[model samples]
Target: MAAENKKKEKTATCYQDCCAEVFNFYLGHSGEHEAILQCVHSVLPEEFKRIGAGKSSLDVLGVGSGGGQVDVQMLTLFQSTFPGVQITSDVVEGSIKLSNNFKALVGKTANLKNVPFQWHIMPSEDYVKQVKATEHVKKFDFIHMIQMIYYVDDLASTIEFYHGLLKENGRLMIIVETANGGWDTLWKTHSKDLCTHTITEYRSSAEIKACLDKMGLKYDEHPVPNTFDITNCFNPKDKFGCDLIDYLTAKEDFYASVTSEVKEAILDLLKNKCSSQKDGKIMFDSTLSCILVHA
Candidate 1:
């Protein structure tokens, strides 16, 4: 957020210190809401007026609402398109700070006057407890998990659990980054074995489909046009050249894997790779896959 820190991170790697780094990027990153909203629109029903017609309010649930940027965008879009729609959203997330921030942002906006929000703060395990209980099942019309399901050890069960939370015709959305980004290259070149993504099982869409089939759920998949572009991720003035080195390199093997020279080269490559070619703007060639299914 500070200019010096920004430069240290360069235009590329601003999210250095925490687990929700990229998620937070959506909150503070300029122009990202537009792209995110685009994805949301494509995934949501075209005629949401009929979503929960005749109901006093639309009840929705979000898993890993994170910084709540996605919810804000949805609220903004709904207010513009369906001005009279009342929304009651229950967000099941654990971070108290992020929840408070989401509350603060939504509370200040007049457009959200018709939207009521409730936070169900708990770990996924506890959430599972309430969800698995028959008395509290099938309570929501919509449930969404974006880039959050990967954390679950038993992903198929997690998917099924969300399915149990849905009311009839209730839709569940899953948004995840496909490994098609220069991610493979980054993983091979700069990323040490310390924190690699799940490349073994359940790595791609094919695998996801298999899991869905095993669960007897039908889904519609869409490719989102957003990517993680870290091209401007550098500051030659600093010793490590970027702030990412702080969080990314914690072990000796990790540090040993990336020397100063390799780091600089990777940064340069990221900058150039992320730069605009066809449209005169940085491009997120990164792939995103979303699924809408019976919850």
Candidate 2:
């Protein structure tokens, strides 16, 4: 009988109305921003530190640097690690809304006074194309692609191109959610409709590692443990519950198009498997994995 019921296709939305709210909701719950910052601060290599100690300038590229919040933290760390040095950062962000927010952040951030940044308002692939079209090639000392690979059209080629942009002894840091996490489960089961066309695949460090191995690339991995509360999601009376569910599924309003039975089943699965109750709080596991490759 259950098999006879057809599942509805997942709806895609730009989240124009809810992007800020959704991002804030995730930040409040996920601890993702802090974890990534800690990962970057701790994973910085000894040689880079030594080289930076004497260098007067550094070149950096940040892909998908949304709102520049995390990018600012990363920049702060770099500044502390290599004081009295000038950093030229090329930031690539596809969304104007997000890029504008990033620019606003830059304007007000006192710590960024010394950092010079070039904003590229386009997808990573387009940035690559534009750079390649230029007669001269620009190499970067560090490139960070944090939680942005899913949006790229060609994952492997894009990564390879970024790696190629690395100068001698330079490093590339890639961050993504773990395949064993709830994100992978949701995407694998419901991605057909829920996944946006701009987002090619929901990949994890595991998949990235395999690709690196196939290419004979050497890298290091760091586990960034994270947790978020989703107890509101289980509350029938909670107004934000639906929004949380939408965020989890990466849809506009997931319940709007889903069948009652399907929605109920998804809610059940999310409650039972994706999260756990502790002290009356429904906590969801949202761990991220960071990988570092050096050239």
Candidate 3:
């Protein structure tokens, strides 16, 4: 009877709600933002120097700018690189809570006082549509989309839209998981069974590179090392662990929604295939790749 039940069970589909809480928790624990910041500091200054040459001001765009922390830091660095160059920044974020947080952060940060920011609370696709409808759309010298491509419907079109918005010698930067990373492995193996195809689309740097190549666009790629501590995920009673699992699986109430067999299979793969034991902790491979395209 047990064997028959297992055989008859259909794989549960993902149903994720607003992930702001889990996302915040992940950022606080995963150290992902810091890793990306390091990559930005290393690569962006040179690009800034090139773009800022013979320019009095720079226009910047930040897509999926969660909480605006990274955007603020990048702008601070850019201002330092080219002193007295005015910055006009436009941000697009889908979450109202995050957008509010970003605005509040910008208000408190003294360095960003001189920089003007225009906030657009919408998904990238909607923003693209709005831009298309406008007769004269503002172009950008620097556009950065970080870890948000997975939510986009069409990667190629999205890239084309943003690439078209770039000014001469401008740069567009996209950061995504590496093809061999833990998230990629999990999605590759279980996406067909678990993904909802609504909130998240499985993507990696490999696909982005291929799309850019097909479009005849030239880009440079940089690898950023990142890891997440998943030690709590093994504890059943831990709230953080449960939330982390939900975020990772891109599902809400993952364990409750799925069958025991399915849950076991996913947990097994996450533990054995996507993570490693290090100093009494499970370190998930959250390695990222940064791709930069010049226009």
User: Using TM-score as the measure, what is the rank order of every candidate, best first?
Assistant: 3, 2, 1
Native RMSD of candidate 1 (Å): 8.0
| lDDT minimum window of 10 residues, candidate 2 | 6-15
lDDT of 1 at 139: 75
Off by over 4 Å in 2: 1-21, 45-54, 196-200
Compose the digit string of candidate 1's lDDT tens values, residues 44-99.
74535445555555678888777687887766765565556676788877667677
Whole-model Cα lDDT of every candidate shown, in order: 0.59, 0.75, 0.85
User: 215-286 in candidate 2: lDDT tens per residue?
Assistant: 788888888887778887766567688777777877666777777886787777676776678898877777
Residue pairs clashing in model 2 are: 10-193
TM-score of each: 0.71, 0.87, 0.91
Residue-by-residue lDDT tens digits, candidate 3, 1-295:
9866532221111112255766887888889999999998998889889988988889999998988889999999889998888999999887788888899999999989999899898778779999999999899999999988877778899999999999999999999999879999999888876555344458889899999999999999999999888878767689889888877886677778778887899898898999988998888999999999989
Q: Which scores higher on lDDT, 2 or 3? A: 3
> Which regions of candidate 1 fall more than 4 Å away from where they truly are?
1-33, 45-50, 53-56, 76-86, 184-206, 227-229, 232-241, 244-284
Q: Model 2 clash tally?
A: 1
Which candidate number maximizes lDDT?
3
